[model samples]
Target chain A: MPLLSALGGATWRLSGHLARHFSQTARRGERPGGEELSRLRLDDLAPTALSAGRLELLFGLSPCLLALRAARRRVARLLLQAGKSGVQGERAELLRAAEVRGIPVLRPRRQKLDALCRHQVHQGVCMEVSPLRPRPWTEAGEAKPGDDPQQLWLILEGLQDPRNLGAVLRSAYFLGVDKVITSRRNSCLLTPVVSKASAGAMEVMDVFFTDHLAGLLQAKTQQGWLVAGTVGCPRPEIPGSSEIPITSCLEFLWDQPTLLVLGNEGSGLSPEVQASCQLLLSILPGRQLPPGLESLNVSVAAGILLHSICSQRKGFPEEKKRGQHL
Target chain B: MPLLSALGGATWRLSGHLARHFSQTARRGERPGGEELSRLRLDDLAPTALSAGRLELLFGLSPCLLALRAARRRVARLLLQAGKSGVQGERAELLRAAEVRGIPVLRPRRQKLDALCRHQVHQGVCMEVSPLRPRPWTEAGEAKPGDDPQQLWLILEGLQDPRNLGAVLRSAYFLGVDKVITSRRNSCLLTPVVSKASAGAMEVMDVFFTDHLAGLLQAKTQQGWLVAGTVGCPRPEIPGSSEIPITSCLEFLWDQPTLLVLGNEGSGLSPEVQASCQLLLSILPGRQLPPGLESLNVSVAAGILLHSICSQRKGFPEEKKRGQHL
Candidate 1:
């Protein structure tokens, strides 16, 4: 008993120490474990002394090799996290390719890695090369036109945590979302933390960064998109009270360019964003969702929402193949 | 951009200094933000000078309130961190609560409170009262039995980080997981930091602690239970192949006592637990299912796995009623 409480107390003190340390390190623009190496800024990282090679992040050694082969003409630098050295002979071969390309390999020290990128478990390796710049919104129509029935886009409003942002991005990719957009001021960039968390999804997704979210959303709405803001309160159109029936939501997706908007983790979607949207959908909190537990981690909430959406789209075909159990 | 990064860096340094200061104070077992007080080991905290009508913990109003509520039966002393008064209605009410209970509210001199609480987020009060007893495994079992179809449990295997454990617990409760079971040696207990992150779920949850997990698990299996370890490569019967519908896998739960086991966040589940389990499940990563991004935050992974299990149980019926879109 007393021993347990004391241990508990010590644990609290240790975490506070750690969180405070990381928060401070982040503010100083230095890695956590590094001794103030340089008073450098993000601007200091600009293409300066040399054109650091354009690195493309791969989900695993296999994709990395394929990517290395496809983009061999443009390759300059290849980097992998030290922790992820377990891939088969292929990863070793990629290392050999880097050796052949005369590309300098950079492995970030674990403890010093930025918490955001480090928290996402990026399999230890991320490329720092300039990525394929996302196509302009107009050109983004190539994959699935704004009018396509199967298209899905994730809209984030005031999600402050980078881990949450990264997880949301990863979830978006897993469920086959076409694109992700966030308010630049309150959102995180496709940093190493977000990249790692996304499990290299950052390398592939069409992530649009902007400060003018309201304007961009307004344009999206004008293009015949049905924007639904997930909120705290229940609405008739929202499927299950506690859990959304994503299949139903997806049925409406083919007929409409669907934009699923989620609000901040602390507060639900803002009223300003809510009022401008076509519908306000919510996952009811059981028969009676308590006020404190009402809020869900933005990423967890996004997973449920995206899963519901995908289940509706994909689960439909399966249901038809096999008659309903119930 | 440079200016912003510089400013951010400054904030990080300042935060680090504060964290260090707190850490040193904690080592000495002093109150938060107070001068060097006497050092006390874990054993010294037992029967810590409790007096009737008084609660003496380093100052902060929040702790005062919590202690008051926790020690309603015989709280005798109220110790406020020095120079921590004259806030507003909420803080002022803290004093009133102590006075109403006839607790001898003592105002420690400036820095004394800091020394006592090791200078963390004291919020104004600390108390000396009866220790919190560990809820037995049987009691935890009754909170939500392992066999309940709706019940969700997080069985952690050798997870070392308190923050990750705390985050997973918070995710479990928010995502409707019934309880979290962890080996006593390998896990951290419910502490102030965890309690804060959990947003009070710790108080409500029945966290079962065990010293021998393998033995406990053996007992569970003896009762005809199913253990699903979240590891193992793709198997035809496993859901990792995507060929195994989530609904079918989950339907197996109706008649069996099911346990969803989670392993170390960075490392995969240990071979012992994996070998002992009846079935092993893995989240298929990618459109084609790749490797690196295959790993997920234990908490995030826990949320997804629990969601997958619960969804299959609850979602199938709901889907049938809505009628298949196909």
Candidate 2:
């Protein structure tokens, strides 16, 4: 998160963006309403000290409290609404944890906290902590042989919804995904709402940020890794749509080191991203509804796909599998 | 919707509730804050009128537009924001359709529209249409034998969020479920927010309402329907934990007449509701996530389960099945 640290692998441009983000987020309540504020670039935030690393502010009770108690990164400060004197239950435990850690707890006015979170659901709490740094994309090359499971990485291309991205992260981590890679263009970054949506999965998930996503995917394909992209079926009953030849989640190859690409929420995969995919996969609709009625929400699709892929990888005894009514 | 039609099945109890709704929604800007108003029940609604079987006043562009285009039931009146004629594109088309149908169009001021919607997101349009009537539970018995696919019904118990209920409805209709039944207690009813979230699925979906939901579920069980309830597993990797013998969704019996019951978003199935389910099933975690690191959002989970069950019902070519990835 510091300018110097990012210089190690990422270009100076990313560092400048990070510097700007700290400044923008620090200037609380600069805007009257913040639907636009949550979708801010790193440059928007005001600069804060990154003694341990880049300082990022996280909001809402779950993320803040989770970060305070469980995050490996340093929780630099805790922010609470003024005159609240700390809430009961989980909130009280958060305050206690902050006290135990000697972290400063600021009881700022509700308006200030509201502005900081851009009027999103903060539930009257926030936190400043070390930035969650993604492992270098190049690290995949240096992995020791046989050290990891068949690598499964998720490449999110142009996912606009922060919550969707967060939900995917939760599923990805839960399903034992090796890493998550976000395409630099048109992806929601680590925002407070995204953190809350993940229910703290944001803190521990292994993530990789990269530019030139299509090119990188192409390179990975050349290296013999299967690059599978998700193509949403408007009607699952009709699997072989006009645009792409799609395999159901049940058919997706599990033995290979694979990279699954999820595209923008509205549009399916971009032409470039789709070209990089060795196979295209989708969730087949079971019961045919009216035309255009069977489209699955993207995050739900991700969960189903992840479950399917993960279960194949961990082939436990068939007896524990119970009766297969399918 | 002509008022005379509603004179059929609904008791005076519903009319009294409808009357209350009109007055409450009309008291816009009445609440010092609108959060409480937004969460009010139908019984809490201030009453208006049911003339000629029409119960008017819906909100948001999609529901109003969708109502005009596809709604089978009566859509009595369309309300556009004042000073803004139904402009080009979808809104304009909606206006033309209403004109062709001889439905009156009123352009109320935006402020009044906001008040009527309780400051919820209306997107500058509202419609006054008769509320969707729920098919009686006895109608399930009258369902023609062997004509439809093995019947699948969703029974929602105690869902608090209107958006979640609406989302479940969208998935239900999309996945080709036969009927949706909601407990009269604690479930968010069909509201404008719900309609918008469903993208207008609320208008056409077959819904049944029952006051004694537990009793009805029991009766359905007695009638030889396999009532399956969803039980959330915090750790899917370690199932059969003291609670119930949970089966994977893949193992869910699709051949039987099934009624899947989903419980409150926060809590799993209640004791009484769980009692009705002959089988408790869940989507197992494919990978072992850290403790408390993995819980699927209820709606996302719903989409996944629905797709899984639906896909199995419509088995395609065995060759296309492409080897069990799971």
Candidate 3:
């Protein structure tokens, strides 16, 4: 009944002022050039953040069986909830995938599934996927020179929140970032909370895990990617220290291949990582910021910065055109 | 030991490279052009997110006691965990505030505090404060005829996540918004989770809650405020309808007192709200978004829009000034 009401509401709105609003013009169907759409479906089964330590549980029939079939990581087992709606399609597909992988499948009552996940909401279907392992840079073939200089690479220094990780990844993937490099030592490890927060972008993004961030940054800097890092501290004035150039996020230019770095939530940058950055970028303070409330949430900051760079790179001209429409 | 370790780490880091960074510039002895610094300590008692009914629990010594003393809302009770350190100032202050208000203060074991909040971290202090009640629009002086036309107002419709609510409020407050308006029917209440997520912004922000959002919007429109709303679907193909101007968020002007409305996390503006908006704004899409992921997280999208408008209103002389620094 609720779903019916929601759809009814959506339809009613679509026929009214929204109809006029959306009829302004046509949007170009072409995705501004990247991988072929053919491989888009292959990433629907990302598994890194779902399982924390050992076997992880994935709920919902489509996400589980899809992950079993398409995830880069392997599945160890499947746990299907007994007696639920819309199981035949995923059940058949799940059985086929399990047979192909030689994995085990178990049918468990809903209550049992609830017990295993500490009373988390597991929507009918669940799977025991392999534990998360950090992906090596070598797996993506970007380390030994000749990598695309224009490729966007982000180095996250010490993000703490799992939800922030998911949000940033979704934005990064949407904005055409090539890959992400993060360290687990001073950051949130990929977990189920992160996967759910990502709303499925975790399945598609290319993330390389690292322990030696400063060292890798030095290497990347040596390779001539314009190394930039974000800082929120309003200008720390060192009497004798030379000023490094800082770019406002609004006016930042993407003239070269870039490696953008973000600092921890509370602490902006570790001294070592701060030393590695050649360019400092900032979201610039707006008027009347409440004390102790100056900086934005880490994930929100990421979305804004990624949007700025991505739009510039695409040469997407909309502001003036949109102004004209107004 | 954990508290000692956390403080030790904070102090140690505070003196190192962080010292050099902070010592570079001295903060203004005054908190800019706002209230006197003498009253700054009053709001330190905000509770962490916990309550959904009549009262909520605020954890940590400073936030709980200070909230008890200074919050416009009443504190029903204070829960003090036995066997914790650093209670001299806040404890003394808390007891005084409770006596003045005739509220009870309970000294409970740490286990009891944990149980009360469903196993949330309490940091040895907790308080039950009054539940949220709708604030009348008259409190902020916006409902009057001669209110400042340059004041900024916001309307949020059907936001579901307490975290997003908190994040948006923090950003809105930091960016100099005058007040916020939200409806409760399809929205997350001002619960303890939201308070924690907001990092205490909820205590200070001037939020006017409304039951009849459409009616209030209509009234505000009649009173002459430039009203706008955001949509993310990116579909510009509703047939048989005439064109309506859509402003890209980047170029949207903040020339007058404005009321910006953001809709539901998933479904976006109900048709009624869409009809009410004189202008429509969108966070422009970047290239090659994942098949199922096009929109950014709500809080992130809010941060970007609020930043844009706030910076514009401030007329921050950036482009060349920042370019030169670059």
Candidate 4:
């Protein structure tokens, strides 16, 4: 039955006028963009934010063997909530895979699916978690460049929006960034909204929170990391200037570690941090790389800069060899 | 007075819980995302489909702007009055820009923003725009090797989410990609939702649409352009491989044209497009790369790719000669 009809008492005709009215009311309440979630009670939800820390996702349309192919140690259980008209065909294969993983097969009630993810879009299955064993910063340093090459890490200063925070994480992960050091205040901690927004990139990132961002940059610079702050104002040419192999500059790591610092959404980098930067880069948009439009969202700007650095190092020798030899 | 105060007189607290339940009932006759707007007769408001002929946007914020902006020649405004508010600040700028260029902005006010945009948040501003203006496929040939390029463009395939669409445009403009192009069917066109998501790039970009994407790709390829696509499955050994400096490979397009094509959100580069590609590369996430996450949103992916290409070209002598070099 259509959700619309279920709520009505009598057979109501959806006169175009009435439908028009209904839609307008709905639109007013809707927030612009993806943050329009109706809040759910933390208690009723079987998954607490605390417990969710241990979870891994098994999401896809039916037939892809991603969930079922996981090793036992890697997965804990499979969850399906597709009622009597339950999962069939490829989705069944996924269930079998979960069984093989020795993961429990849990079937949630249909209403529960609505409860799990506010929107009724969780197609059939989800997974109970197998905790991700915590790792230390040194272990997280796997992203560091070898051969005395330069590497890039990002320091996020006071990002408030969860979606923006999530976007930065996703950008950092895909762009070969080493790690992200974020400020504890006025920042969104990793949450479900962050997870969903990141589209599953939340798993491998190394995010640590600290009190002072400026101090961290200073300390890292002392340890041989070239710290560059993304500034709002114009400045000198970035390191290596003309013919500066961006990829090489990014991978340069200056025999020292490298840290790229970003600031708040509305405000650009903090004055203190800007003063501390070895190179204050204003990623201009054109030939005379201009200052950003009155303001550029921090996360969006971060993606632009990170991509620049990571892209420089995109296909080192081997891939080129493969492209050439293949 | 706050909108909530008006509701309090009706015996309801304005808390989210009450709002949620109230929404369920009051929304029975309401639209999906906003307030119930009064519908105006067709005779009262003149409207069209897309201001650009490529998108179908619902202008429901300020109808006056709709009247002012949707008067372009090629633009057709479809008013979603089924309760519609016309245009907002920056988006109005696009429609207004189109109007200035003699493109007609349409104003059909019967449809609601929700109906036109499904459940996506259009912010009461929707547009039916022509595809972004396509650049001559031959333009890439103008860029020389080692010349810090003056202008850059980004080409994408199959990016779906409007937010990603908006974000990519936002980053592209901020980072300096002058234009953007994508397949008509697989890509989301510039709608009011996209304009809002873009923060303002929708107005700045020369976005173009094409029904036959392969033809566009073929045209560019024939123009001596090097097209690279990002592929990160099996998580390559050489992450960020596509970013390295290949003076040898780039020399081919140093004075020629270049186009970096990003594949779909999840399944990047269709096999067909990949086969047609000059290079298939991947951005290595370093050790910080997430375990199961496949990729970043398409626009973000493009941001990373375009930034790398542009940054690399900056190192060349030609780019520096063009102007005050960064």
Strongest candidate by lDDT: 2
* Candidate 4 residue-wise lDDT, A113-187, digit = tens: 454444423455555444322232334444333444557778877776656776787778766676777776666
Error of 3 at A11 (Å): 41
Evaluated on chain B only, candidate 1 has a TM-score of 0.57
Q: Rate the local accuracy (lDDT) of all candidates.
A: 0.51, 0.65, 0.62, 0.50
The candidates' DockQ values read 0.12, 0.23, 0.23, 0.17
For each candidate in turn, the TM-score is 0.63, 0.71, 0.71, 0.58
Recovered share of real interface contacts in candidate 2? 0.36
In candidate 2, residue A309 scores what lDDT?
75
Q: Candidate 3, residues B254-275: lDDT per residue as tens digits?
A: 7667888898877777777776
Error of 2 at B215 (Å): 1.4
Model 1's DockQ score:
0.12
Scanning candidate 3 chain A in windows of ten residues, the lowest lDDT window is A3-12
Query: Which has the better DockQ: candidate 1, or candidate 2?
Result: 2
lDDT, candidate 3, A176-268, per-residue tens = 787888875777766554555666566656788777788877887787777788866544553211255677877777867788898887777
lDDT of 4 by residue, B112-152 (tens): 33444443444455444433334444443445434533445
- Per-residue lDDT tens digits for candidate 1, residues A202-230, read 66667775566666667777776767667
In candidate 1 the C-alpha lDDT for residue A41 amounts to 26
lDDT of candidate 1 at residue B3, scale 0 to 100: 12
